[model samples]
Target: MITNMRKPTFIVKQSLKIFCLLTGFAVMTWSFSFTKYIRGQFVNLNVLPERLKEYMYFMGRRLNGAYLSSLNKADNHDIPIIFIITPTYYRLVQKAELTRMANTLRLVKQLHWIIVEDFEVINLKTQEFFQSTGVSFTYFAQSKRSETNNHHRGADQRNAALDWIMVNHNPSMPAVIYFADDDNAYSLEIFQQMRYTKKLSMWPVGLSGGRTYETPILKDGKVIKFLAWKAEKRKFPIDMAGFALNANVLWTYKPMRFSTDADPGMLETKLLERCCTWAEIEPLADNCTKILVWHTRTEKPKVRMFDNVLEV
Candidate 1:
């Protein structure tokens, strides 16, 4: 009886050990699978820091002469174009402003201008100005501004321009697009510095009057962070005029449009949230260490109007 009892006890002990081992193995396998799933989710979301690191690694590895040579040929055949989207209202004061922008473009090569009027039709002076420049341009009017509930005409007009570009242009064409307000000052070197933009390019704008006059956070010739009061809550903080976008990214994410409903300082956050994070934005114009553009607001000119006479 004693021998038989010992034999049964040993068998039970061995069985328990085997069960624990099997359970441990299953738990480890499940943990590994869960980790992989989380990583996949991050990639799909295009979260800034991780995505930017991955892109940099890819660019570094592919930066060889053979790769560059092939890319050069391909780029020549399908050259990356630039489109400057400017939204304007019917203010007659903008004539000088538009002329300044036009003169700046003369220093930039191979750029397309998308000038949208926040009115029912383009006025004669605006039409004549564009025609006289002989620069590549597309003119359109968002006539429904007065009828719409939206008051942020700038954001709406920019979105319209983006929609127009996606609808009319080839998706594969290399292009860089930027929103240039009518009165802002642009530097010549800004365009040259943004030439090799892969995803998004950024530069510093002067006189923003935040913690930093410029928002570019640079370490080792790369943009690591953006310090802006506007995007303090968001993952990255940047001004609308501070960055440029690649056309492919825009086309790939077609319906990603700007929101006029975003509260005063939230427009940049809302737009960036739809696509990439701070990490995915590439730095250009030498990490914006040198001031290239100024975020100068138009000074309200003092003028006197008496019956039929106007004095400035």
Candidate 2:
């Protein structure tokens, strides 16, 4: 019985070896053909069918860690850094809104979040919350000019963030600047597109200016005009979330800062005019047809009920 079992085990081992050897030989043969094709050699293309080429490409991407190692890499000096400026104010759902935003921003590559709170001081609780989220961030406080003023109070905080950037980041460094509001919902694709902004990049914004979406009218990869509800009234009728700037633009055009003194709902236009003209705006998101960001607002949560029940 022992002799019979040994014979079967040995046969099985030999069979496995033969199978592996045949698979290796087939892969090597195909790899040689693929290499030749890659080098522009028009060899017998029948060796690599469409389906086999697709399979090998997919497997090659996986094995080479293209999708697995997107954020952290051994060498990424060529990648441009993205500076995201978020102006936040205390609210019933402030923490919840920030937590949701951070979850999305964490997936972005080469990002630095600059969150400026509209408060007199940066509270310890908020500091601890930002740290716990694990998103690389710089938290600071800049009090609103008036306690009761509701006319774009975030303008001051945004300017503060811009000042911080100007002082901290070098103008020679390759970087992109985006004003990402905490209440807005963002798609990671926008980050990818904005990373390559040479001067000014604009895309569509969903649910902006009392419309389904607002975008720049592109003609031959250039912005001809804006397709917004208030396009006629405002010089640059793009939403704050719809545009991004190359860091060098801000460095060179030092006057490009947000101001509450601008006409109502014209803060975006005010800052944009100092940076670029309509012709200079580069239309992104497939020529401004796709919306990669949305002006979403979270409802005020009823946390007062939790006051008498349990700590929330």
Candidate 3:
């Protein structure tokens, strides 16, 4: 009887030891995963204080003149410089849209407009437009072909601007980049919102994504979901006009490119998915309350050719 009691007691003690060991192992595994996730985010460029500080210095500068000052700030430079990448193809409407966009952009201070053309040389109108308008701009011509079909557009023109930025800029340059289609309509207030982006920020875009508006659903200052019901089946289902990534993210993730392998309308999604996820995205434009941009495409201008010559 004494031996039997001792055996059962020993067995119970061994089982308890095994359970404690397994529990400790599970806890360690969970802790390691959690630490890795937090470390991954903190390690990214946007989280580094030095990078944001470098760019913030420019926006915090004050200047005289009603046009120079942001409505909210006495100092016009107290915002991130908006680096506008416009990929334009020659068209009669191109001049009109460029002029309109320039007019709107001039109202915003600390902005750089980079216009890249699809052809091997800059368009004459593009050169003339910036000169007369007095907008801060850099003009470049893409060395490769642009769109060969309707399915392919803005890839080459956009890449040229990205390449320029990568070569000329370092990770510390303080700026927010936006791909502004020539036809879009934007509010000056939008630049201010984009300037403060910590990582990647998204807002509502009008007349895009086969819907009236495609926007993020914000919950307690974070993006919980996107509102474009039509794009529910797609990954990162948002319009190109819907989001802007911090230039720091670009400098850090220098390999980002628009690829032919990407499915139609996912150019923005694929490019961004690798950089940040929906949870990392910060929703803007009044916490998803306002529409600061519109995809306002102008009617294609009518052109005529007579006697085997093109007519404008």
Candidate 4:
């Protein structure tokens, strides 16, 4: 009886020892792999105090903006830069939305992101987030003013971005400008199609206008008419996600802007009228048959209880 009891106890002890050893090995392996990742992020760091550098690196472990910095430094004069203008407002999902957009934009080369906030003053938290995104970006806030009932939402913010381009952008530099909404889904292929837009380029937008998609009907590689809900009513009936404009167009037509007083759904037409006509519109993405962009809107989060607890 005593021998039998001892044998069972010894087996239990051996099993426990094996389990602990396996657990410890896993933890050590994970630690080493994580350390390598952190060290890799700081490989290109050249000039900063050790303390500050450490703080910055640890604060944003995903420092992958090296590609944009290098591209900006390169003397590639022929590569047209795609300037993406995003007008954003404060909301529970704002950070999450921008983070998603940044991840996509980071993969794109020669892209400059211009984000305009609909706030009276610049938000520091947002600035830090943008810096960590690893994409070339310009950040600013919209001017404060009372809005009339007829003024379309986000018109001021979009106009502010265009204003920045007018004052700051070099017209001689080959570039294309796109009005990218924060909540939309964009494919890198769309960026490629619009990169060398001579005047104005357009493609199909998925899930827009309460339909599957909206696009400009093309005939012989030219935009003949829009295949949208109110195509016959407006000059440019497609959603904002469907088009890209040449940066030179904005510079050439200095006063062009989205009309604040334009009725709902008329903003696109107001701006496009100043830029190009139907005959001048260029079709892209296999002559407008491809759905490269989506007008996706995030469902509002129920954060009443969580709002005061922490930032979402």
Candidate 5:
């Protein structure tokens, strides 16, 4: 009697185990089918959020337009239009410097000179120099000085020139814009090599005190980093005179003038932060291989005046 009962119990336990396994398999199949069905419905209905669709559409259109425009412009017509901005104050030493720069630019025809003076009126000598050059030039002077700073009103002076460019010329027309100091020496070859600039072109500058050279970090014919004491930590670090920018970039960023409030060594950082990125920077002058410009400063000459005699 006990043996017969044990066999029935064993049969019942085995049947229960089989039922649970079958039920689990059926549940898993149903879950999988439901998931597939939902995915299929989403795909067929194209049920993406409206905002996402709009964003993607806008991006696609913008990219297409940029691509077509770039393709049209890339005809190997390396005729780069260069605009030079020079901020001048108390033009005694700058006369020779300006002459040197003007002479160098004679070889480069597509050049526009924008000279900003830190005064309400342009000096007679500066006026005469520009008149003699017969080059395309514009002169601007700041009306007043509100701050007592070494780089007093420098930001305002630069902004005045930039504003003039935007108003007078097509913002996207020029190929390169350079911020040059009145005292620095520029090489003619610098202008020639800058024609290859897609965005920004940089090279080594010869500074004072036998410091030898200054330039950006190059890796595989590209600037991966900036090798300057001023810009080691910043995304890119080079002197204001070390690089040339595309006019389109200037229009795009539209920096709000240079600031005296900024800490020392912050001018480049602030200006660059607004307009440039590391990838856009192309380093030339590799180990002074293509050094065309030198960071030269003019020394102020002394003049003695005799009584009852006027010095011109």
Candidate 6:
């Protein structure tokens, strides 16, 4: 019995040896020192089993650390940092949205999250979640605003974010300001598109309304008409995700605030009133040919009214 078991054990040892040899050969072809590479990887050999925690260095560090490390190695010195201002209200899906957004933002280089809460005190849970993202972020708490109803407070929350940026940043800093709501589905290209906004850049927003998309009709590279049929009379009748402004635009227009009493969908229109003119609006995403953004709504989960979810 012992002799029979020896043959199988020997075969297993040979297989591991062959795997190590192949790995070493690949490393050598990549212009790495085979011995040194093996030494470093030896710490992780335990993941294959028959070894213990002392040999699990590869599993010791989180996988994202290696991903972030690679991002740092890329030539990104001049990529303008984007300040994502998200106005979020506390809700059942707030944390879920932020976590999902963080996963998206992690792939974006040189970005910061400025989350403004719609309540008085900073939510500790939200703050901790932001810190855990492994990205730069700032959390602020502001008073709620409601025009017709108490829940119509996103406009006020947005204004507070702008106010925070104005107070913290220099007027001439090289940054692009984007009002990114927590619940929207953003494409990675949105960051790349907004990085070079000289003044205010506008794009077509997908999944808006019940049609294909809402956009600014461009004629010879200028905004002629905002393409919306229902609410034809609003001033700047566009989605909040439809535009981005340069940092200088905010500095030039001091005390930029959203109107609480403005029409339900007039926040974007009213805010841009003091900011960008038609001539200054830069049409992007192939002059509104491609749709790269959507107002993705996450369906709220069903739970008991008095259920203490936090305790779970």
Best by TM-score: 4
lDDT of each: 0.67, 0.77, 0.70, 0.77, 0.64, 0.71
Candidate 4 per-residue lDDT over residues 78-191, each given as its tens digit: 699888889887666788999999999988888888888776656566778888877888887775446545657778888878877777667888888898999999898998
Report the C-alpha lDDT of model 6 over 85-149, residue by residue, as the tens digit. 88886566777898989999888888877777766656665666666777777777765753434
- Tens-place lDDT digits, model 1, residues 52-93: 433332222211111000011122344567788899865435
Ranked by lDDT from best down, the candidates are 4, 2, 6, 3, 1, 5
Collision pairs in model 2: none
Order the candidate numbers by TM-score, best to worst.
Answer: 4, 2, 6, 3, 1, 5
lDDT of 5 by residue, 129-241 (tens): 67687666776566445663545346677777777767766664556778887788788877777765777777887772245666676777767665566555555556677
Q: Write down the RMSD of candidate 3 (Cα, Å).
A: 24.4
Candidate 3 TM-score to native: 0.69
In model 5, what are the clashing residue pairs, if there are any? none
Give a tens-digit lDDT track for model 2, residues 155-180: 98998888888887878879899999
Best by lDDT: 4
List candidate 6 segments past 4 Å from native: 1-77, 145-151, 229-231, 305-312
Q: What's the alpha carbon RMSD for model 5?
A: 26.3
| TM-score of each candidate structure, all chains considered together | 0.69, 0.72, 0.69, 0.74, 0.67, 0.70
State each model's C-alpha RMSD to the native: 23.8, 22.5, 24.4, 16.4, 26.3, 19.0
Overall local distance difference test of candidate 4: 0.77
